[model samples]
Target: MSVDVYLGLSAIDSRRAVPRATKCHVHLAAKPFVVVGYHLPGDPGAPIGLLCGTRRERPSTIVVGEPREAKLRLARLANFAMDLNGYAAQFMQTPTTSRRALHTHRPANGPQLVVANQATAQWLCDVMGRRLRYLRPDGDRPVHPGLPVAGAHLSFFAGQRVPGSSLVLPLTEILAQHWVTGQLPSLDANLASQLAWITDPGAVAEAEDALPAGPVPDPEWETREFSDAIKAYHQLVDAHPTRADQPMTGTIHDALRPSWDACWQALDLLHSLPPADRARDRWTQDVYQWSRHAERVRSGQAYFRKRPKQLQVFRYLTRLERLTADLSREMALDDPLIMAGHVAAGEALSGEVVTLDLSGRRPSLQVRPHLPFPRPVGTDLFWHLPRSTSPSGPAWPIVRLTTIGVTPEGLITLDVTAGAVRRDRHDRLPQPGQQVVFSPFGPRDYHPDTLPAELPWTHAEDDDE
Candidate 1:
C-alpha cells in the first residue's frame, strides 16, 4: 500500500472510498472470459451452477440438476468443458510464434480465465480440478470424456496462478492492489464492498442490489429462495422431465445475475485505467506457460499430483518467493505511484543530484534525497540508473553504495562507489539537478539447482542390504 492511498483512506472516513492508484495494476485481455458461480453450501465440493462468457449480456449458464448423481453432474461439467475448449480453439488459428528456447511450437495467445476473487479461483483450481482430473472413460466407473479434459485445463490454470502469471486473474485481488477502502482488508475481499468503495458512495457493503458474489451462497437466502426453487425444480423434473428447463433457468439466472453484473462493472472500472507497463511482459510469460501446458495435454502427458513431496514443496515455495519479490520490484519500477509506497517506507529514495566529484580518484557523485531517510548513518544504498544510461543495453544499470550520511539540515547524501565506468564522458554522468532514484532492487536471477535423484544415506542400510 502507498502513503497516498493511506492518506486517501484517512480522508474518506465519511464516505469509505479511496483511489490508491492512477493506473491499473494488472493486464486484462481484450476479451476476457468472466466466471461467476455458487456451490452447494454444505458440500462446497459439489457445484450448483456457473455463469461464464466474454460478455455479461450473453453469458451462458450451466446448472447441475441432480448434483448427487455422479453421471448427471459429469454431464453438466462436460457441457461446460466443451464451451471452454471451443472458446480456446479460436485462438489456435494463428498462434503467435516465438523462437525462444521454451516456446518453439506453442500458441502465444491462449484463453484467459477470470473470477471474482482468490477463493473462487481456488475453488476451480484445487477443489474442482481434484474432483475431475483423475476420472477415466475406460475405467470400471466410466465418466464423461470431457470431464478429464476440463480437469486437465483447470489443473494447469491452478498452477499458473503464481505471482507473475495473469492467466487466472482474480478481480478483487487485482482491484485491491490498485485501491484502498476504508473498510477492513478482510471485508474488502467481498466484491460488493470493494465495488461500493470504488464506484457508489451510497451503496453499503453487501447491499440488496449488490448481493454476495459467491461460490458459497448466503445461508438465509439459500434457505428461503434457493431451497424452495430447487425443491420445486426436483418435483417438476420428477413429474415431467421435459418441462423443468424453464423453471431451473429462471432460478439460476436469479441467483447469478447480481454477481454477473458486478463482474462486468468491476472489469469496466479496471479497463478505464491504463495498464501498468510491466504487466505485458508478465502476460507474455503466461502465454509461454499456457502454450507448454497445451502441448503437454496434446501429448497425453498432462497430470497434476494430489500433493507434492517434501523436497518438491521446498522448491516450489522458494521459486514462488523469488517470483513474488521480482514482481514487487517490477511493480515499483513500472509505476511511480506504487514506488511512492517504498519511498515512504524508506526502501527507496528519489531526489536531484547535488554535486559531482569527478576530480577525486574514485569519481563519485553526491545526491540529496528529497524524502527523509529512516536508515542509519553508514547504511549502503545503490542507485538504479535507467537502462538508457548504459549504452551497452544492460537491463538494469547498477551503482554500488560507497557511503551515506545525513547533513545538519536533515537531508541525506549518497556517495556512489562503482557505477561511473564512463567518467571521462561528461554525458554519462548524471548532471546536477537531474532527478535520480535508488533502491535495493537491481538486476538478479534465481535458478533452483536440480535435486539429486537419490538421497544420500547418513548411515549404511543396516542388515537389510
Candidate 2:
C-alpha cells in the first residue's frame, strides 16, 4: 500500500521510510518492524544520533527521510533521543556541510524545523553542542554568529549573559507587546480624537466658535493651513513662470482666495465704521488690522528693508489718528475740540529756533528752526532773500523771532513783536522790529532782543549756552 501523509500546504516524499520498514520486517521473518524517531545532534557538519525504544519487536536499522512526518509518532513512542550513541541517519531539505543549518527561518514569520528518528535526533544534538560552545553560553546570542546585531536588539542584547535554552525572540513582537501592555505612555484617546477633529478643515470654524473672542481671531489652525497653501502657491509660481500672471484657479489657490478676500473685506468694513462704532468694535478692528498687516507682508508689499522711512512715518501718523479718534469717541469730545488740540500741539512743537552769533565777521547769519514747518513764514523773509545779492559790513541789524502766530486768514502776527504783517504777497513790508538786514553774502546778523518778547519762544535749550 502506498501511504500518504498530508501536512497543511506542503507535501513530503515518504517512499524511503516505507522501504526501510519493509526490509526490517522481511529480515526478521514476521517480527514486526520497530520504527523509532530520532534527531541529529549538533551543527549540520557534525551530526550524530542516539537509540530510541522500538515501536515493534523487530531490530531495525535506523531510517530517516523528510523529518516532519515522524514528530508525532516519535514523541508518542518515548523512543526519540538527541545527543546519544546510536546509528545516525540525517535527512534535511538541503544537505548541511557544517554542524549547523546554514539558513534560518525568514523573519516575516518564524523558524520551525524538527528531527524524526531518535538516532538522527541525537546526532543533531551532538553536532549542535560544538557550535553552541563557540556561541556565548547564553542561548540569547544569535544563531548566526559574527553578523552585525540588529539596531533594535542592540540595547537589550549587547553584553547580556544568556542561559542555555533561553530563546532570543525577534524585536518586532517584543516592542508590540510593550506597547500593548501600557508599558509605554500613550496620548488620551478622546483628546487625540478631538484634536483630529479640530485640525479638520470642516470642523475648524466650529472649533473657533468654541474658543473665546479675543483681540484677534483664533488663527492657529488657519495660519498653518494658509502657510502650507502659500508654500504651494510659491512652488507653483516658481515651477511655471506664467502661473504668476494667470488667475489662480487651482484647488489650493481657490481655497486660500476666500480667506484673503475675507481679510480684505474685514479691513474695509473696519475702516468704514465711524469712530464711535470703531470703539465698540475694537476687537474686530484689531483683527482686521492684524490680517491686513500680515497680508501686506506676505504679498511682499511691505518688506521692512524695502519700505521707505516716509511711508513708515505716514503709517505711524495714520495709526495715531485712528487711536486719537478712538479716544475722542471714548471721551465724548466734539470734533472742533479735537481739531483745536491737534493744531495747538503742532504749534507747540514748531515754536523754537536758534540764531547763529555773527557779531565780528561779515555778519552772515544762520537760523535753524527746532521743528520743520510746511512752508516759509513770510514771502520776503530774510533767509528767502535773493541768493546773488550783496551784503554790507560786520554789525548789520538782524531781527530773529522764535515764534510767529498765523491767523486762519494768513495774517502773520508775532507774539514778541506785537506787529502783524499782511504776508499775502512777495513784496510785503516787514513790520516794526522785523528789520531785514542785508549782508554781501545775503541777509546776515540779526538782533533777537530788538523784537517784542511776547512771542512763544520755548527753546529746547536756553541761550545761556
Candidate 3:
C-alpha cells in the first residue's frame, strides 16, 4: 500500500480525510459553469431541478413544477438549454485555423460542465440527452428549439467522459481524488457528506435535515415540503395559464441551496490546492475533443446509433486502457505523493546518487535506495525522465546489487552494457548527489491507429440527425 492509502486506512480512528495529493490533477477553469442537478425519486427522465451559473452569487434556478407531465418537463428545459448554448457559444466564437482534429478537428478550449457526481452526469447525458436530442423542433409534436440544441451539447459531453476529460467535471469524484475521506468510499459520491469531511475533518453523519447532493431529491423533504407546494403550483398553473409563480422559484432555490453551496465549497477547496504541472496541457486535449463534437454537430450528421460492433468495443477499450495508464504515469511523475505508491509496492525507488563512473566501456551509476527494498539483479529500471523530448529508443539492464555496511542497505549498481554516452550529453544525465526516481514503468508501445476495414452500421444511432 502507498503511504497515504495505508495511513488513510488507519484514519478511521481519527475521523479525518487524508490528503492524497499535493497537486490538483483535474483542470479547473477560472469560471467553470457549475450545475447542481436533481431528478424525481423514481423518475429518471423527469428532472426535478437544476441550479446553474458561472457566478456563485445566485445560480439561475430551473425547476419542473410537475415532473410527470412530459410537456412541462421539456418546456422547463428551454431556459436551461439556452444557458448551455450561450455558454458554449463563447468557445466556438474563436475560429480555428488548423486542419480539423482527427477525432474532432475543431479548436482547443471549450466550456466545462460541473456536476455533483457521476449519477448526475448520467442523468444529464443518458436520460435527459436522449429524451430531448431526438425531438424534432419542427415536427407535429414540436418542442422548444433550445431543447434539442442543449440535448445535443449534453450528448456531446457524454462522449467526452473518457479518463481525464475536463469537459464534464463531477465535483465529488474530483474532490475524492484530492482527499480520501474517513467515511465509507461509497459515501464519497455524496457531495455534501464529502465536503463536510473536507471542511470539518472530524464531522460525522448527523440527523440534520440536510438534502443529499444528488440526481435524486430527498424523499422526506418531498413528502413534507415539496409535494404539496408542487401539487398546489400545478393546480394554480392549470387555473391561471398566464400567471407566474414568483414564490415557487424561491422555494425551489431554497431547497437546493445546501447542495448548491456544497458544490462551490468543494470547488473552492480544490482551487486551494496547486494544480499539476501538466493540467493545462491535458485541458488542451479536452478542448480539442470538444471542438470535434462541435464540428460534427455543425455538419448536421447523425450521432447516436445502435451499432455497437465488436471491433468498435475493442478499439474503445484499448483507448481507455492507454489513456488510464498514461494518466496514472503522468500523475505520478508530476506529483511525488502519487509516485510513493509504487515505491511502497517495490515497483519503484528513489535515492540520491552515491557515485557515477564514465571511465568504463559503458556508463554506470551506484544508487543507494532510500527504502532499502531488495530488488533482483538485472532489473531494468527507467530513470525517471519527465523531460525526455527525444524519440523512444532502447534501454539496458542493471548488472549489480550490493549490501552497504552491515545493515543490508540496497545499494544498486546500474550498468549500461550497450554503447557509452558522449561526454557532452552529461547535462541530461543524473549527476552524483542528485536525487532521482527509477521505476519499471515505461512508455506504452506505439502502434498506428488503423482500423480494420469492412465496418458499417456501427458508428451512430438511427435516431441521430
Can you give the TM-score per candidate against the true fold? 0.88, 0.15, 0.87
Question: How much RMSD separates candidate 1 from the native structure?
Answer: 3.8
- In order of listing, the candidates' clash counts read 0, 45, 6
Candidate 3 residues 1-465, lDDT tens each? 567667578567567777788898988887788888778888888787789988888799988777788898788888899988888888764443343332234234578898889988888877788777888889689988888878888888877788877888898889877887776778888777777676775445641236777788788877877777676677788677555444456667887877788888888898899888667666777776666677766777637753465677778888898888878877886788888878887878688888888887557777777785566666666654444334353322212222223224546777644222556544445789999887656554668777776455765345656
Q: Pick the candidate with the highest lDDT.
A: 1
Candidate 3 error regions (>4 Å): 1-4, 94-108, 207-209, 242-247, 385-409, 416-420, 455-465
Shift of residue 459 alpha carbon in model 1, Å: 14
List the global CA lDDT of all models.
0.74, 0.26, 0.73
lDDT of 1 by residue, 1-465 (tens): 659656566737757566666777677887777888888877766787889888768889988775666677787878787877677656534333463532334334667898998889999877888888898988689877877878888888888889977888888888887777777678777887788877886786445345568888877777787777777778888788876555656777788887788888888898998877667767777777776777777778887888765567666788798889989888887777777788888887777777877675665666677787677766665666554534455545667564567678655665556666456543556778888777767666756567655444642234475
Task: In angstroms, give how far residue 194 of model 2 lies from its true place.
Answer: 30
- Order of candidate numbers by TM-score, starting with the best: 1, 3, 2
The count of residue-pair clashes in candidate 3 stands at: 6
Candidate 2 structure, TM-score to reference: 0.15
